[model samples]
Target: MVPITRTVPAPSSVRTARAPRRVTRPAIPGVVLAVIGLGAMAVVSLWWRDTPVIHGFGAMLTGAGQVLGLLSGYGFVVLVALMARLPPLERGIGADRLARWHAMGGRYVISLVTGHVLAITWGYAVTAHESVTSEAVTLLTSYPDVLMATVAWFLLLGIAAFSARAARRRLAYETWYYAHLYTYLAIALAFSHQFADGASFAGNLAARVAWSSLYALIGGLIAWYRLVTPLLMFARHRFTVAGVRPEAPGIVSVYITGRDLDALGAEPGQFFRWRFLARSLAWQSHPYSLSAMPRPDMMRITVKARGDHSGSLSSLRPGTRVIAEGPYGAFTPALSGRRVLLVAGGVGITPIRAMFAALPRRMSEGITLIYRASNPRDIVFRQELDAIAADRGAVVHYVVGSRARLGYDPLSALYLRAMVPGLHRYEAYVCGPAGMTRAVVAALRASGLRRRRIHHETFDF
Candidate 1:
């Protein structure tokens, strides 16, 4: 357990830059298959309009089945992940990966619904031999199942619409979470429509098997992710608040120690959205990185009291029961090989601190830290940072924002620019406020750093 150490160079200069584009297309094989399958079905339904009504109905049913099957699988995973129900062995995917899946699944589900709408319109056109819109309205109004499907379609649409960053930015995580919870109800409606009226499963034994198999798979996955995993956790570690101390003004650090944390199988630089039973903080959980390396015996999370729920965290008793909903991010230091550049702002220092502490003291890899805070008092782990640097020659630079004579420009871009002389040759780690991380990332890329070389932890965004 020897610590890594190396001589670090002084940072070069600072630059101000805009936030980089954070949007990425999440990879989802199931969703991709559904999109392709639905598109093919749409074509078949449209082309068979003049054929027998049974033929067109059959095509639409097949497409609907494929789309529903795919969406159900991915959606089930998301539900389990959000609920902290996934088994320890299977819950390795972090928030970044989850968000990517969510985005891809969302797009695919919309595409499937769009295909469903188009195919149904064609079916109506062939059956009524008139305006399909009129027939669609008729179907929607006449059948309860059809009505439910339409309602579910609208709900899915709403969820997808608000899932966008622009809309999500305006809502609190709790509101966004609750609003999105309707996804289950929407899917239930979809299930009813599929079983009750879907031609694929109506009278066919194979289709019945297919539907039954889908239910079993989705059901088993749900049980594994939600009920079984949580039950096992409650039986084992059963977390209770060990202590809550203010590490800095308006910043409280909650200490939690439990059995079986070694079995929790988390790494340094990851975070959890913590829940406390206190009435003031119970409604929503807040994401906080383990401020120090987890040592099986105890875990520490440093949280800044920025919002109503977070602000009241200090009021909780030491013995309060707590539920941690994560270990849900992927900013671990394992991916890098060259020297590491760790950057933080305000409360953003937690994950970086963990990585710093976790590294061996004499391992010869270079490390540099650029920590920005409002003032001297706002810094968390100030003594720890000093001690680590003193022991290992880890270069530590502090940017006191409010005290700067240049009138407190956001130091994120500046820090990145200052470090850029050799940064392109090393790995970059950033965790902090979204604005700061964005600015730094943009600055690095604008200066021609490769995107792969820049690594970051998941934050509130």
Candidate 2:
């Protein structure tokens, strides 16, 4: 395994919560139980194939597992569709959680699909022992939709295997994206088969109603997350490119404006996934933090053109229609009760800047911003910070060292009293590269700050 080093600074008060060593034992017992259940059902079904009561009981239990598997499958689809349409989910929520669900859900899908195939195959083998495969194949072929479902299952398995991080890293985003698109096809196939070929749904009215109602709920979530939310966003915030300007080397700021002030109700420190509709940059949809707070009619998305997608954003023209799907995440500093201590590194200062601008006047809450970057050039909105500092008594400490190809930064003892003196009193909000955020949070925690008093945002994904 490749060793992954966490770049967080050592905390003064490290909380020791070690993970349990033996967690896999439960899986063994669960698998054993499942096997026993399957075996008992198979034996009973074979012995009483013609009897309605026995067959129905056996079918009901197996059907429950299959239905559960479909729900998991639907969950996987909904997550994908929603993530694509929302901004805060893709970044602040972290890709790790989504990836975990994808993995576990895939396993459930496999178990369900396997149970479905095995149970049906066993029933066929017992009743039509001589030509099981041939008869099943003939039956499927007779029903075109069933054949489509079989093809869909093959596709689902192939896609599931390809979804491994190793394989995904090798594939282009578009290719990976399209491959997963086959999920909708797979779900359609599976659902159709459940209603058509299965006796569980056909003969039993209650089962059919229950199953259909469950499917409707899943479908509703998918529609809300994907279609309805996006449409509402577009209708309310008709975001058009207000201005596009380069902040630093390759970093472009795209200002956008919506219909009305109240209509585009996004708080400061929130971000959006921006997709510029320019023909050349159509495929480029990325998450960018709002550099400035929402005015009566405008918002800003500042992008550091680093990757293959981001680098092309510099050439985008003004007045470009950018589809923004967001106002997601709970990273805002308002969550914590203590005074705000904003920590920013490099371009990560964008959100911090917005928060400062949007802060209400005559505010009793104390605010301190620690701006850390290699040099002064990397500080995106220095002028704005000066204005904010002058307007409010908010203390702004600018730490510019090791930037501009400079060697080393002297450890400045700024904000030492603010943190250590108060110890457990202040709320620390951090946003930057993963390493920077981790290090800052660690250092703050080390200085006797409570974990609940710390809020951080890392745009690693």
Which number leads on lDDT? 1
lDDT string, candidate 1, 173-237, tens digits: 77888988798788777776766765444555665575557556666767765546544665687
Writing each residue's lDDT as its tens digit, candidate 2 over 1-461 gives 11112221211011211111121112332453365357445434433442354355345544443444344344444444334433434333434344454566566666667565655544554555536577567657775366766777788788877776789778766577678778777777777776676554457677567656756766776677666776677777777776666677667677676787334555566666677889876665566777765655666667886666678777766667777766655466563343667788888888777776655544325767788888666777666687677766777788777734554332222244443346357777788888877777777776777886777787753
**Local distance difference test values of all predictions, in order:** 0.64, 0.61
- How far off is residue 421 in model 2, in Å? 4.3
TM-score of 2: 0.69
Q: What is the lDDT for 17 in model 1?
A: 12
Q: What's the distance in Å from true for residue 312, model 1? A: 2.2
Model 2: number of backbone collisions: 2
Badly placed stretches (over 4 Å) of model 1 are 1-93, 141-144, 160-167, 202-204, 280-283, 402-421, 446-448
List runs of model 2 lying over 4 Å from the truth. 1-147, 170-172, 197-200, 213-225, 228-237, 360-365, 374-376, 399-423, 438-448
